[model samples]
Structures are given as structure tokens and as C-alpha cells.
Target: MSLLKKYCLLGAALWIACAAPAFSEYTALSTLLAETASKLEWNPLLESGVLVKDTTQVVFTVNVPWVIVNGSRRINVDAVRRQHGALVFPESTAKEIRAVLEQTDIPPKVFRVAAIVIDPGHGGKDSGASYVHTINGKSIRVSEKDIVLNLAKKLHVTLKARYPDKVILLTRENDTYIALEDRPYIANTIPVKPDDAIVYISLHANASMSSAAKGFEVWYLTPNYRRDLVTTASVGKEYSEIVTIMNDMKEEEFTRESVLLAGEIASQLESAIGAVTENRKIKEGEWLVVRKAKMPAVLVEVGFVSNLEEATRLMDDAYLQKIEKAIYNGVSHFIEQFEQSKGFTE
Candidate 1:
């Protein structure tokens, strides 16, 4: 049987999980052809399938991965099938059709960097975690809040210098306290066009009773794509409704992008620090600052200030520069990759 027939049968037996893969992996062109006047015109020698959907045209080349939706080449293409009886296209190709049919809000072809929102965690009255050290019989104290704020400032300076025209906003420029809820608001409020991108980076210093907890880490929101965490039937009515509402508030696309941003930042940071805190690799974190942000967001723990050695290093301006530079480079890398994927140049 064709893949589409198999999936349809399977879906009937068991509800296809996760919103039914946005579109089935193997969608027979025959099915789409039968449903509409959309013609399946292909060249055997060229191994290409062209589906003309009104003004929008979807083109798929077999073996060679890539699809053209409405004349624009899309890289999200998987393998296009030309051998399975007629021709079957990958889900991405069908998704392109679904986007047009369903009127899905497709991202812009060109992505513009609108703003970079920086949140320096724990300020003003909140001293955060404290680390006390003695050097040459002299006592020194370092607070997580202070260290993070300093790093945030350096990062701001570096990013501003790099992208002078782009808006680089900080939740708190000084020692003044900003509530966790307010931080995301500040970022979400940034005026942006539909094609523009806004990234939220929340800086923080880690603290633990065990001084061994050292090294930098980045966090993104846990994936909730498969299950409806917001409306689980097992949970209480009031709580379930609240959770569902909150989960629904989070954009799945943004969460995926946030994960990518976190991974890039953590990889660069681990390289600079010369230590891979395996435990600190890109993982799920529900930090309010990151979770609530409407845009792609990540929370980075620069280092464990609780450790005497790390605390000492945090105090050093040179060390701070290195960490800040890594973060700056990571952000640059992310932007470059994002723009390239969207077919943006220069």
C-alpha cells in the first residue's frame, strides 16, 4: 500500500500524535491530485514534480533535496519520491501546501534582527547568592547579582558596538531590581515588524553549596510539542486550565528557535571555558525570564560564583571579557545562521 494509505489507516486506528505531524510524512500526489484540479506535471528525466496551486506553485525535485514553494526555494525539504508508483512528496512539501490551504502564518522570507533584549538577573535589593573568599588574609565577597550585572553590561557594550543600528535593550541597566515577570514584558514590548526577530538573553550567575558546580550553561524552555501540557485530563480542573492557558501562550516555533539559540551559546561557551559541564549542556529550564518572553529566549548561567576559584575568576575583568565575548559571538552566529536559512544576504 502507498505510504499515505498506510498512514491514514494507522491514524484511524490510533489518533496520530502531535497534531498529526503538521502533514503526513508520505503524502501521495495522487490523493492531492484527485482532491483538486492541481495537476501533477513531472519530467521523468528531470525527476521533478510541479503542483500548480492557483497563483502559488509547489515544485519538488526527486533524489536532490529541496523544494520551491511559490517560486521561492525552501531548504526544509526532505527526500521527494518519484519511484513509489506515481510520486510521493515529503511532509515539508505538503506543509507548504497546507500553509497555503490552511492559511497558516508562514514566517517571512527575509528575517531582520529587530532587537536584542538583555536581562541581568537579580538586582537591587536581591543580592542573589553570596560567595566569600580569603586572599592573602584579606576577605573578599562576590554576589551573583553583581557578577551577572557586570557581565550583562559588557555583553551590551560588545553587541552594541557590533550592531550599532539594531536596538540592544537591557531589562535593568544598573542595580535597580526588575521583577521576573516584567523582564519578558520589556522584551515583548519591543516594536517589531512581522519579518523582524527579537531575541531575549537573561544573564545569571550560578550558586551551589558544592563548589564543584562550575562552568557556564544555557537553558531553553522544555519542548511541549507532543503532548498538551496545558490541558491534561489527569490534572485538576482549575490547575489544568491555568497550565493549558500558559502552555498555549508559548509559541512552539519560538521554543524551537530558543533551543537552537541555547545550544549555540552553550557550545561556544564550553569551548571558551575549556570545560564541558555535561550536566550544564542545553537543557530544559522554566525560568520565568525566558519562559514568558514572546520571542526566542535563553537563560545563561555564566559560572558558579559559589566556587572560590570561579568567584575569583569572575572578579577578574579579563575572564569576564572572555565569557562575554563567547556569548556575543554565539549571538552573532545565531543571527548569521537564521538569516542564511531565510535566504537573507548581507
Candidate 2:
């Protein structure tokens, strides 16, 4: 054999051997399992030792001290050594690591939400509901439109104070009526690039004829209803495919995170107001407000204005201030929770 030919054949064999192991290694790992692996250019700090996989859990050692698994269809990583066998990741460390990985263009193992839209339901001629009261011996009427506007303003201020650069928008800042459909339309119209993370929150006060229902309640759109309605409504229409595409996009954007966010907000609200109000629990509702929103959307019924006692409280300036504080605290708590879980900051 000639010298050049032999060298060429040897080089080809080496390439094949190297390629074979790369392919084999990934093949042995399930796609779902492999997804748990960090896409960040594997750093020495993150990959100094071998990752040992066992039947129930996976472990890493030395510089590669993080453990990861696909839990509940999401990638969960923990630093087993630092926690002294605990499962939680500290917020500061996680945020730093995530920022580093993100800068390097690594697809995040979990998604984090940043921007939010707040909608205060009802306004203008809508009047919503009216309640009369005698204040200092003069009759006064409290309108739902005004109450919600004030609440939305308070929420926007609180969110911006915490998030700063995070975009917080309101559907209506004044008593002017904004159509039900236009609320979600504003969310959909936001010029968000594919890489941006945003969510929507619509605030409303619930009313009941019994005047007995009162408390804080949070809501995420009912998925089954939104999907079915969009699908059915689009059938035989020119934009059927468009509707399918949009529905699919919305599902991808919202579904999982929306539920988590709703729960977090509800929990915080309950904590904030527990001393003074009833706990109405978190729930899912199929209202048009939630259903049509393009992002992970939730509608919060802060309390029922129907209950005479609650109505009186709602009309009180001091009570409204308390409600504002509670709602703001809930939203802030939710944002912090989301950032921590997804390992993001700001």
C-alpha cells in the first residue's frame, strides 16, 4: 500500500470511530432524558466528572455536582452536594448559572415569564353594578368600574416597582369602556418576538345575587374550553388553519405556566388578606377574558361586591388600600416564584 493511501484510510477510520461513540452515547439516552442535559457549552465547572445514572435518580460529582431529571415534563436540576441532600436550588446561584447559560445561547431547561398585562374589568357607561351608601348622611354610589380601575392602577405600580424593566400594561387606565374582546386583543397585539417571555392578567370583581359570596379568587383560562371553542368556531371558516395554528401556539405559550402562576398568586393573596377576608380558593374559568388572551392569561376576582359587608368594605378607602396591597403582594410573589423555578433574574 502507498504511504498517502494508508494515511487517508487511517484518518477515515479514526473519524468513523469517534463519530460512532458520539451517536451511540446519545442513542443510549432517551430523547426526553437527554433533554435534561444542559445545552450550555458544557463548562468545566458543570462537567468535571461523570454523571452516574441509576434506576431512580441521576448523580454527578466533583465539579459536575448538579443532578438533573425530567420531572413532570420539565427539566429539574439540583446541586445535591451543597444542599446537604436537599432538593431545592438556591435562588441566587440558580439565577447566576441561568444568566451565564442564557448568554451562551443555551435553550433554558425551564421557561420563565417576564412581561405581564393587567386588565381592570368594566368601565364608563357599563357602570357594572351600583351600590348606594350614606356617608356623612349624604347618599353615595360606588361603581364597579371605578373600583377595578383603581385596583389595576395599584397592581401596575406594584409590579413595576418590583420588576422595573418588566413591561406591565393596563387595558384601561380610565373609566372609558374597553370592549371585552379588546382586552385580550391588546395582549395579542404586543410586538413580542418569539424569544420574549410575557403573560397577561385580567382583574375583575365577582358579584352574586345572594350577596354572601366574598373572598379572593384567581383564575386561569379553562384549556378544554378554549381549545374546543377555537377549534369548533374555526371549522369551515377561511381562517381555520390560522385558528389551529394560533390555538396550538397559545397552548404552547400558556397552559402549564398559567396554572402555576394562578396558584402562586392565589396563595400569596390568601396570605396577604387572610387576616381580614375570606379565602375563595384558586380556580379555572372559561370566561371570554381568559379564553381569548394570547399569552398565559388569568382573571382574578378579588372579591364579591355583592355581599353587603364586603360591599361596604369595598367602598371604604382604607379597605381598598388593603386590597391593593394584597393583590400587589400576590403578583410580586408569583413573579419571584417563577423566576426562581426557571432560574432567571429581573
lDDT of predicted model 1: 0.69
lDDT of each: 0.69, 0.58
Name the weakest run of 10 consecutive residues (lDDT summed) in model 2.
Answer: 48-57
Query: Where does candidate 2 stray beyond 4 Å?
Result: 1-112, 135-137, 227-253, 343-346
Evaluated at residue 190, the lDDT of candidate 1 is 84
Give the Å shift of residue 65 in candidate 2.
39
Tell me each candidate's TM-score: 0.65, 0.62
Report the lDDT tens digits of candidate 2 across residue range 109-131: 44445578988899988877666
lDDT at position 187, candidate 2: 83
**Candidate 1 TM-score versus the reference:** 0.65
Question: Quick one: best lDDT, which candidate?
Answer: 1
